[model samples]
Target: MTVQSKQGAYHTGTYRNLLLEFGYSEEEIQRRVLDNWTQIFEGGEDTRIYYESEDGLGYLEDTGNHDARTEGMSYGMMMAVQMDRQDVFDRIWGWSKKYMYMTEGENAGYFAWSCQLNGTRNANGPAPDGEEYYALALFFASHRWGDRTEEPYNYSEQARKLLHDCVHKGENNDGPPMWEPTNKLIKFVPALDFTDPSYHLPHFYELFAEWANPEDRAFWKEAAAASRAYLPTTCHPETGLAPEYSFYDGSPNHFHGFGHFFSDSYRVAANLGLEAHWYGLSDDLVQIADNIQKFFEDKDPEDYRRYTIAGEPFEEQCLHPVGLIATNAMASLAVPDSPRARAAVELFWNTPVRTGDRRYYDNCLYMFSILALSGNYRIWMPKN
Candidate 1:
């Protein structure tokens, strides 16, 4: 039997606490959320992924590479907001603005995607994925904790201005826009023509339409619609695996050897799940999530491998099995009652957060799955 839709008739700021519904006691839910958060953000010695520098800047390092990425920094900030850790959120935001924000160039208003521990820019370019996450996290921060008078601390204004630049960057002929102007789909980067399937977060765009500058609200609304329509085309009909990068028409664009279902493609399931939970905009998403879970249902997590969209495995082993499992469990938010969904969640519950050098990405996805499954990853509304 297919999973039943939980799409309520209207949007509520809150969602069903799935953990409770799944037979987890309140104490169990609270402990799991806090324990996971502590392990990720403040665990003793062997477990924590976040750290503070001598200069008081807090950053999340991709320990495997010995570098900081906007992806991790912004993701850390988002996690901080969702968990109500304002101090941690402020610390991460301060580090991002101090080190990652670009000031006078074609990419001004955008952040440098990578940096060093000493706050040095590793590259002068921006990544659209990080910028979008940064904007959404800032918006949530403004609603949850209110804004401040300082530069980067003016959360709502910072988010609004960033969204403005995302769609209007090339109007003065300085740099290309982060999104393609005509179709309103986000680019892999401002200079590219293809899209990252995981980068199309229509739920975030729906909120942007409501919170961004009035002049750009229409564009964001159109973007939400465009992305909702775009995702189904990009995913495989039978397997539901998406490429890391694809053209606007949903064909894989293999420019950088990212045409397969690899590291970046894992988030597509999670994104689609959240979109369904938040806005109830697409029923097709449930089928997509089902197809993905069913394809891997019987495979051992340790043997998970990289594959083409049609489900052909390659010699390359899966880089982050914990992360893949986490996202697969997260897809349960969209397809709650499927046997595969239950199996995925059980697997996640049994797996601990990854430790050691390559833990950053896996742990981040792990924490996100924890939040989403507990129904704590919410839309914080502004206090009037």
Candidate 2:
């Protein structure tokens, strides 16, 4: 069996293992990663974010809302796979397939965006972000652990099917495609004409180009380049804050009052950081991360709030300061020399995984930041 080597411009040897680079002992890194995962997925106290049903199904819930979201479930799957916890991955996948998948109707191959804990659908519509994560997680699972003969357990096939549907849904009159066919950009949702800036994950798209069905490989490649080029346009030239939603031309779309740097836009830095680390595409992203970190360097974390792309703070407070901090720290992976990058990492090191009603998003970003910084979040290729 041969493992695939890195194909991008970045040399693997230069990748920053931030924990080790920051003087963390190997033991300390292991302990912290495990401790964080345990608190999130296994803790018995109120801080535990995941719950398992009597029937063996498991889910990560947004405590603020009683509903289950595909975002959390797919994220749980990715985390579990990266941590080599197949049990956790399978449980979440089972719960998702049982409850969230829409097997019939316009969205047959797509998973529903939200559901009740008892396996009831809260919305039949699918979210494109969930589908993208689900596909990537499934592909990684297939590579890390050999696929089974079962339906949902057939990881590679399931991933291929999902990707096929993502790009081809409208072709068969099943539903609108998650991505715009002409531009190859991911939409906020299948029916939406605009996109979430944070949703353009070029790193994941790069891998998709290599692993997705042969017929669609070129499209995914174009998508990776399109997203890489689109990011700088969406982000502000000075502050580097991206809007939550934007048009195909990369201009902020204010149709739904989402034209500001808010909760969803926080992932832009994290995404750019990871993409740069994985593919060595740091030329433009480094400056962007620097600008973002510098913009927030003087602002107190306690006072972190929503802001216009131009850097004007909103009167409303931030909903996920921890998430913002985590992502900013993750961005440090792309911009290793920035003082603001170091400060962001230091602040994240001192902060604990959020616990309480709003901990879901914060903790998810926290875990990803932990994985990315420590060099644990990685691409798992199949051995052949």
Candidate 3:
């Protein structure tokens, strides 16, 4: 397999289980990870988000919205592949391909961002975040379980085709590309002009550069570098809080008043944490993680609120306080050597996966944090 020059987990094949590092037994860590999965995927109806149809397909419901979304489906696929649950991965993929994949439209190659439980389209548009995760998760599935000869089960081909469409969509005057070609930056949606800071996943793009179609490899490589360079500019100098949406120039986009730190912004820390764990965390990333952890060190999750990048709080309380906690703890991966990192981990360990109305998003982040901090989340390489 080809390897990057950087000393990342993909090259070294080594991962740190922070819970074990901090004196948790290996058995406990493994059990905790499994328990969280069971709770999310198979527990009581109150806790479980995954539902399987009699036809052998499955979908993750956004409990709050009461619909299936590409974001949750792709995330469930990624989580399944990471945990070696091929059954779950295939079911989710099948459901997604059957229900969400749009054909003969402006978004012909893309999946509808949202769909009803009965597989009805909620909107005809696509979300770039979902497309990115879908491509990456499919790649992981191909490497982990091998591709099939059938349509949706041809995992590697599915991934490559998705990536190809993401970059080349506008060439034929069909739909706009998910990323801005000139800057190599991902837009919030295929048709939008602004970007979500949390969508900048450089680590995933690095792998795409190596595994994507040869003609698109250079573009993926440039996209990876561009995201890495763009991230630091999105965060505040002191607070390190990033806006949910920003412009290509890294300034917060005031469009729809999304320039504040809120629900989507929480993923920025979690993304940086995973990227730092996979690739080497740079000093700037370390500082960014440090700033975020320090900023919330004394704050209670119950009081979490919408805030400006400068750390000013709004009257609005956070919709996903549990998610904020999980992501903040995940940020510890970037600052593993700091006492603050240990503190964050301790806090996360004490928390439980959320349930009820808004549990889907929060619990997904919680499960990811569990996998990542325990080093269970890994890069699946080609077997041959």
Candidate 4:
């Protein structure tokens, strides 16, 4: 990721596969992920908006230059590979190593939030949220690349830090990752906000558990299991949708917004568009959709999901039908030949842009969920 600069324009790239490769056939996902691998590189690259985008990249504008931490960048980069954009993957990976932290600084192995629009940490310290993403990305990177040395991170050491030093476990064993003890866990800047880190953590650790020490494996397993348990553990048997919320003591805290559309959209997006499927590891996107649909199906218009902290439910309903992800996921997995599959993809493709959004919380999430959904790089579509 890059910082906003007024004098000159620059861009940075990452290759994390946000959804593991949804919608496209596996071969298609591989093709795009491989094709766009060069944007991660400093100079050597092919042609793609990733390498050269007119809209601007980095912090200059909305070309996804924010959240350049290892987890964020790595996750995006990995997903780029999943999208079959190897050019983007290679470019992002090639350049990211220069900015990566390997020294034994207090925050070593973790990463800073932003770097130069052109290069690495010519900037400052990473956001405390780094641990959360680093852990998440590490899981996928190791699985995808199998070379920790290549990424400037030792999976063993990094996982150790995430479990013992970086994570802040709670009653559910799932909470915001710990930042510097120097902050004594009270710093306000990184205190859990309404940020999006929910589904990733589970996917991360589940992959780690596959290659970890027996003890480490167990730890990652527990963490993954806890995350699954903490989420919408139940899905609709029919439509497969459910509520989205951050809970404290199994109750809601709506500071961000209860079952907010963005998070809800993500669940829809992830399930309908998830790239990978591992039993007991990554949560099932299809099942999640069905349950979410169930969660809201029979409820009345006045029905609402809210933070119980205030002892009240705010009346709200999702105004957008990002369910195209869900429909696409089903299509790619089960009904590849069906007309509805193409229609579902078309609905998602035209949605919000050509179709117009029915609801939105912030344009950031609107962009985030859509882009993350597209990270798979479905080549069957015209652009791919």
Q: What is the C-alpha lDDT of each candidate?
A: 0.88, 0.87, 0.91, 0.38
Number of the top-ranking candidate, with TM-score as the measure: 3
- Residue 316, candidate 2: C-alpha displacement in angstroms: 0.6
Q: Write the per-residue lDDT of candidate 1 for residues 1-384, one digit (tens) a residue.
A: 232334621265567566677777889888999999999889965678899877776999887788889889989988999999988888888999999998889998899999988899999889998988999999999999999998889999999998998999999987889999999999998988889999999889888998999999999999988987898899999999999999999998887788989999999989876776776646576788999999989889999999999999999999999999999988888888888888888898889999888888999889988888888888877878
Q: On residues 219-317, what C-alpha lDDT tens digit does candidate 3 reach at each position?
A: 999999898888889999899999999998889998988999999999999998898779876777778889999999988889999999999999999
Q: How many residue pairs clash in each candidate?
A: 0, 0, 0, 64
Name the runs in model 1 displaced over 4 angstroms: 1-10
RMSD values, in order shown = 2.1, 3.4, 2.4, 12.4
Q: Can you give the TM-score per candidate against the true fold?
A: 0.96, 0.96, 0.97, 0.50
- Between candidates 1 and 3, the one scoring higher on TM-score is 3
State candidate 3's TM-score.
Answer: 0.97
Better of 3 and 4 by TM-score: 3
Return the TM-score for candidate 4, rounded to 2 decimals.
0.50
